[model samples]
Target: MIELNWEGVYPAVLTPFKENGDIDFEMFAKNTEAQIKAGVHGIIIAGSLGDAAVLEMDEKFELLTFTIKVVNGRVPVILNIAENTTKNAVNFAVKAKQLGADGLMLLPPMRYKADDREAVEYFKAVANATDLPILIYNNPVDYPVFVSLAMFEELQLCPTIKAVKESTRDLTNITRMKNRFRDRYKILAGVDTISLEALAVGADGWVFGLVDAFPKETVAMYNHVKNGEFAKALELYRWFMPLLELDIHPKLIQYIKLAATAEGISTPYLRAPRLPLVGEEAERINKVIADGIASRPKLD
Candidate 1:
C-alpha cells in the first residue's frame, strides 16, 4: 500500500445500485475512472453520500474490494465506517485494513449522540484497532455529535487518527484547527458548497460529493485555486454553486445520483428507502444540473 496523502480532492463516491437492489459495479467503475482521470487524489467509499446507513457490512466490503481492484493502486481507497457501536466500528476497521484499504473515514457513533468524552474514546478505540490511517468525519451539522477542538485534544494520543473531513460548515473552524493542531491534522473541506472558500481559507483538500458528477470541472477548479487563479476558480465556482448545493440537501444521495445520471456516468437507481427523484423536486434539480452542464466552462 502507498502512503496516505490526506490532501487533494477525495470524492465521497456513491454506491450505484441496479434496480434489483444489487451493486452496479459497471456504473461504479465508470464514475471512479472519471474521478481518477480528472486528477482527484483519493476516493472515499460507503460514506453518508454513498448510502452507508442502509448497506450491509458484507455489501460494504464487496464495494471496497471491487474499488481497490478498480483503483489498481493508482490512488488511495478510504472506506467509511458508520457503525452504531464501537465494537462494530473496530471490527470493520480491522477488516477494511485486511481487505487492502489505504485508510478509513470513521464517523462518530451512530443513532445515540455521544458526548465529548464518549466520542473521543470511540474514535480512539477504532484507531487502536487498525494501523489504517483515519479521517474523522466531523459533521456535527448533520450528525448529532460534534467533535470539538477540546475533544480532538483528547484524541491526539491516537497517532493513527490523522486528517479530518471538516463538515462543521463554520469555516473558522478550519483556522482554529490549523491554529491549535498546526500540521497535525490535514483538514479537507467536507461541504461541497463552501469548498472553494474552504480551500481559500487553508483547507488542504476537499472530500466532496459533487465530484462524482462533474469530475473534470471539480478538479479544474481545485487546480485553478491552488495555482492562485482566484478569478478563474471563482468564475467556475459561481457557475458550479447551484449543482454543488445539491450535495447538502436531505436527499443528497438522490440528488447527486440524478446529477451523475445526467452526465451518463451513473444510474438513477438506488437502494431501498432511497427512491429515484420525481415530480417538481426532480425537475428543479435536473434543471440545475442541465444548466450547469450546458454552461460548463471550458477547461484547458
Candidate 2:
C-alpha cells in the first residue's frame, strides 16, 4: 500500500561538491550527520537545494544510495526524483524504493507547460511506474505551474499520491485544502518564510532550505508548535524570519550552503547554470546572517 510515513523537520540537504565540482560523498555524509545531530526528524536528498538541476543520473543514484546508508536506516529519507520526463522520474523513484528510501517527492513537470488535465496525467504516469507513496511538489516559482484544488482532489484519488508539499504560497488554496482534505493527505509547508503560518493553516511540518543554517532553532520551533507552545515558537520564528526571507531567493542553495559553512558544516558551492551569491548581495546576506546569529534568542 502507498503510505506517506513522513513528518517533522526534514531539511533538503545541499549536494556538497568538491573543489572540482564533483559530488563530494564525504561532505554529503557529514551534512547528514549535522542534521541528525541537530535532532532533525528526517532527511531529503537530491531536491532543488541539492542542485538537482545539474546532476546526472549516476550522480543522483549515488547520492540516494549514500543517503540511505548514511541515515543508517533511522530517519525516513525522501528522495526528490524530479526529472524533465515523468518516466525518468518514476524510474528514479522505483530505484530509490529498491534502495530502501521511505518515499518520493516530485516536482511539477517544468519543461512543458501543460494544462491541468495533462499535468494530472503526468502525475498518474509517475504513480503507475512506481509502488512508493508520492508527494506532489508545488512550487510555482521554480516549476511555475499551478495545479488547481480540483486537481489536488484528483491526486488524492490517485492510489499512489499520498501528500502535497504545497509550495504555492497561496493562503486561500492552503486553507481550502486543509478544510477539504483534513483527514486525508498530509499538508506540508514547502516555503520557509511561511512555514509557521502554514502550520497555523494546518501544515504537518516543513521541508525548508534555511533549516541548513539554524536547524536546532527550527527543530525547537517545530516541536514547540507541535506541542502547543505557540508563544515560544513564534518568538523563535520572529528571530529566524530574516534568514527565512533569504530562503526564497533563486540563490537559496548558495545562501544556505554559506550558512552551513558559517556553522562549520559545508562550503557554499553550487554547480553550473547557478552561480554563487556575490557583490553587495553577498555582503548584505553575510551581515544579516552574522547579526541574526549574534542576536538569536536562547530557548534554553
Candidate 3:
C-alpha cells in the first residue's frame, strides 16, 4: 500500500472535453501537468468537478490510468468513487488499486440518500474490499448524506478509512474533529469558500475545485497559512474570495473551466446534457474570472 501524506492542496480536477464530446486526453494531460507544476500535493481524478456522474465507467478508468501516467509518482493520484451501490463502489475501489491509484476520495451512496448507519456500512464495505487509504467525503449541503463526527467514530474501526473531506461547510466541525480525533484522521477542507477559515481552525489540507484554474494562488495561499504567514494568506484569500465563491455554485463545472480557459490551461467545452455558459450568465461569470485575472496577486 502506498502511503499518502494526504495534506496540502489537492484539486478535484475537471475532465476537459472536445467539442464533439470526446475526452481530450491531451488537454487533460496539460491540466494535470499544470497542477503538478503549481506544486499540488495530489491530483483527484473523476471527482464531482470532474463530472464523474456523467462519465462512463470505462471513461473513468481511462482517466485514472492517464492521470497516474501523467503524475508518474511525483505526487499521489487519488481516484473518486461516487457510486450508488456498495457493490459498484467496491468494484471500482478494487479496480482503482489495480490501476495504480495512490488513494481514494469516497462519497456516500449517491442519489439514494443512505442514512448514517447505511452510509457507514457502505464506506466500511468498500474499505474492507480494498487496501487503498480512503478519504470520506462528508458534504451534506451538496451530497445527500452527512457523515457526522459520531459516524466518524464508527469509521475509525476501519483503519483503511484514514481521512475525512470535511465539506459540511461548518467551520466549527474542523475544531470539533481536531478536538476529538486529534490526528487519528486527517481532516481536509472540502468546501472551497471557507477553506482558509477551516485551515486556520485546523484543517490538514484542502480538496479544492478552483485550483483547476488558479493553482499557483491556491497553492501559495495554502503554503502561507501552513507556514503561519496569516497576513500574506489573508491578502491572497481576500482577492481569491470572489473567484473562490464560484466553486460552490451549481454551474461550477462551467465556472471553473472558464477560469482554467482564461489561464490557457483548459478549454471551456463541457459534456452534454450540460451546455456551455452563455448570455448574461456567461458575461457575469466572465467578469469574475476577468477581475480575478486582472488583479491576481504576485507571490514570492
List TM-score per model, in order: 0.99, 0.95, 0.98
Q: Candidate 3, which segments miss by more than 4 Å at Cα? A: none
In model 1, the runs with Cα more than 4 Å from the true position are none
Query: Compared with the true structure, what per-residue lDDT tens digits does model 3 show for residues 1-300?
Result: 357978999999999988888898999999999999999999998999998978999999999999888888899999999998999999999999999999999999988989889999999999999989999998898897988889989988998999999999889988889899999999899988999998888888999998999898999999998888999999999999999999998889999999999998888898777789889999999999999999998889
Candidate lDDT (C-alpha), each: 0.93, 0.81, 0.91
Q: Name the top lDDT candidate.
A: 1
C-alpha lDDT (0 to 100) for residue 76 of candidate 3 = 92
User: What is the Å distance of residue 221 in model 3 from its true position?
Assistant: 0.8
Give the winner by lDDT: 2 or 3.
3
What's the candidate order when arranged by decreasing TM-score?
1, 3, 2
Model 2 vs. true fold: TM: 0.95
Model 3: which residue pairs collide?
none
Candidate 2's residue-wise lDDT over 68-186, tens digit each?
87888677788887777777766777788887878888887758877888888888888887778777888877786787788888877677788788788886777888788785777
